[model samples]
Target: MPVVREFTLPDLGEGLTGAEIIRWLVEVGEVVAVDQPVVEVETAKASVEVPCPYGGVVTARFGAVGEEVPVGAPLVTVAVAASEGDDDAGGSGNVLVGYGTAGHSAAPRRRRVRPVQTRPAAVPAPQPTAQPAPRPARSGPLPVISPLVRRTARELGVDLATVSGSGPDGLILRADVTRAAAAVVSRETSAAAPEPAVAWDDDVVPLRGLRRTVAEKLSRSRREIPDATCWVDADATGLLALKDQLAARAAAPRIGLLPLLARICTAALARHPDLNASVVTEPDGTPTGIRRHRAVHLGFAAQTERGLMVPVVRDAQLLTTEQLAAEMARLTEAARTGSLTPAELTGGTFTLNNYGVFGVDGSTPIINHPEAAMLGVGRIAAKPWVHDGELAVRQVTQLSFTFDHRVCDGGTAGGFLRFVADCVENPGELLRYL
Candidate 1:
């Protein structure tokens, strides 16, 4: 008789409530060893592979791909043998030692090694040592490449395996595909068609997943929140000088404008707490009240392959510049690699979108859900401006703030922006607060 056991989904980390099934590694009736990979799940931050805890034949799978499963839900079932020596039927059902019960054995069987025969040395001419067998050739289909590279290859008529991969794990990448396509085009110049002078219709692209979610959130934010945005042209000459001075100092990770911006925003929030609060809707669809969070959890917008993810730096008010930089670096790396947990992506009290990296002057960023306000930072440029009635070139950056009118009035938002500008204009004055 075969023993049967069920395995539940374990919490990956950070108190994640659920995850979406990306793919299943095993199928029913297949025998799997303990700790073998069974399924891949995609959470808010990243995708992780889960392994089986029981060694047995797979009996059933609890969920399918693309299904979101809650924590502690049964994921799969397997059947096992009751005992090795006892063939009798009444010895108790097959119990998986790692999962269902504690009394069952967990040790894996070890293969026995054969002892060398002494008589073989005495044999005439001593038979030649047995040659090691050659490795078996790889069978079935060729390796898989990324979708982007595949599409590019099809359009350019390039062989994927021939291209050298520079990406992680020797996998074919977009750059490699592009270079291969370019080489092909260069070699077959005579076969190329003449460029068309007439304008052609652009292909219609479909929005799904991340892009769709972003569109919905942006629309909802515009419709639900009575947003009031204010832009301020701040003189950051002093801040740049301070940054230069700090960079010269000996430190493991050099601090930059991002951490300084975070510090300034935190201090401004402290001065004007209303800008940090947001309105909450009741379960019945009525306005419950304004929810004010005491601590500042600053969310920084990080653009990733999946979509836009904002990982929060909790308790920003209590951290120093170096600490803030380290946290920002860690969270941003996690976001890029899809390793951020659900909790780290949620529970942000305020958000900041840095469009400066893209060379944009200014943009009114949408407020993340349940957050009262969002701050946008534009490119820092050296522009000629009037200072004390004299023409001078100064470093200027645009700061835009969008706030929920229900939580904070226009006056309060203006005050917060002004305070931030003051800090950026005079970094020396911020030392008092630090």
Candidate 2:
């Protein structure tokens, strides 16, 4: 008899507790290799493909796509040949990407597994727009794998044995149950007097996946953090002039406006180390004490099709303007292509949000939680400004700084913003800290 081994969702690390199933890579009754990616999941940080350490015939999958599964919850159950596993259901000591195992199991040889037939069972149905096809009558163990699916079927009075499965290998999915329930309603409605349809669900958007994560985090930031915003208008003429002069030089690495500002922000953080820290909070979210960081892990906000992502540049205080430009470019590309790792998306001690790319003047955006502050840069445009005691049209930009009031008072926050503004106006002053 093949030993049925369950594979749980391994911890993806970086303080993540659960992940939303983005898509299923393998189907029921498919033969899988050791360490083969079985599913793609999106955590609070990034989307990661989870591989199974045990190779065998996949008997069942636990969660539906778009459903959140907690860490340690079963993801799939594989029927491994007794010979393939050393002891009981012979398990592999093989490790997995985006997850970790305690230790390797010795003498676990990679072997091919032929798909096995699943014991049949029934599941109830639920309401769905698409109709599910009919399945021949079968009786056995429940065909449903996920407990949540079973719950839905029970609540909706769906009969698992009667309902047809639209999932892989006749596995009854939650949607199939939902569709069954919907069909029952439709039939019942036809028996009654015809009423006009409301189309109530047309405009309703579900807060799920990335959008849900973003919403929860932003809500926490607002609820927990005592934040204050401060802004300043600076003459960016000197900054633009400096960029042009540097580009004119040989092998200057194609300087950009954001990198230069990033350099300035790092210099300012170095001067005021107080801003480069996170507040240690209690279980009740009480601010206990301030914890200072030695290195500056700067995060820049990048908007992707998925949602807003902050890709962190490790040790931004150490990167030169050109180096910062290159790293920022790399991270930006990764963010846009949705290839960023969770490590790259987290542990940001401070954030730089260049909303200027969106053609906005200024915004007092919410501070990214746990981080002390975020510097927002707006569009740089030619505007009427003073240059050396003379009124002239100069490139001007609005820089806004939002900080956690628990870490520092208004005076410290104002000073940090002032230093950044001075660097923008005088460009050469940025060299003193460099």
TM-score of each: 0.65, 0.78
Mind giving the per-residue lDDT tens digits that candidate 2 earns over 272-357?
99999999999999888999999999999989998788899999998888899999999999888867888898788999999999
> Candidate 1 lDDT, tens digit per residue, 232-307?
9998888889888888988557888888889888888888888788788865435678988899999999988878
| Residue 178 displacement (Å), model 2 | 5.7
What is the Å distance of residue 414 in model 2 from its true position?
1.1
Off by over 4 Å in 1: 1-4, 8-19, 23-37, 44-46, 56-219
What lDDT would each prediction earn against the true structure? 0.71, 0.80
Find the candidate with the highest lDDT and give its number.
Answer: 2
Roughly what TM-score does model 2 have, to 2 decimal places? 0.78
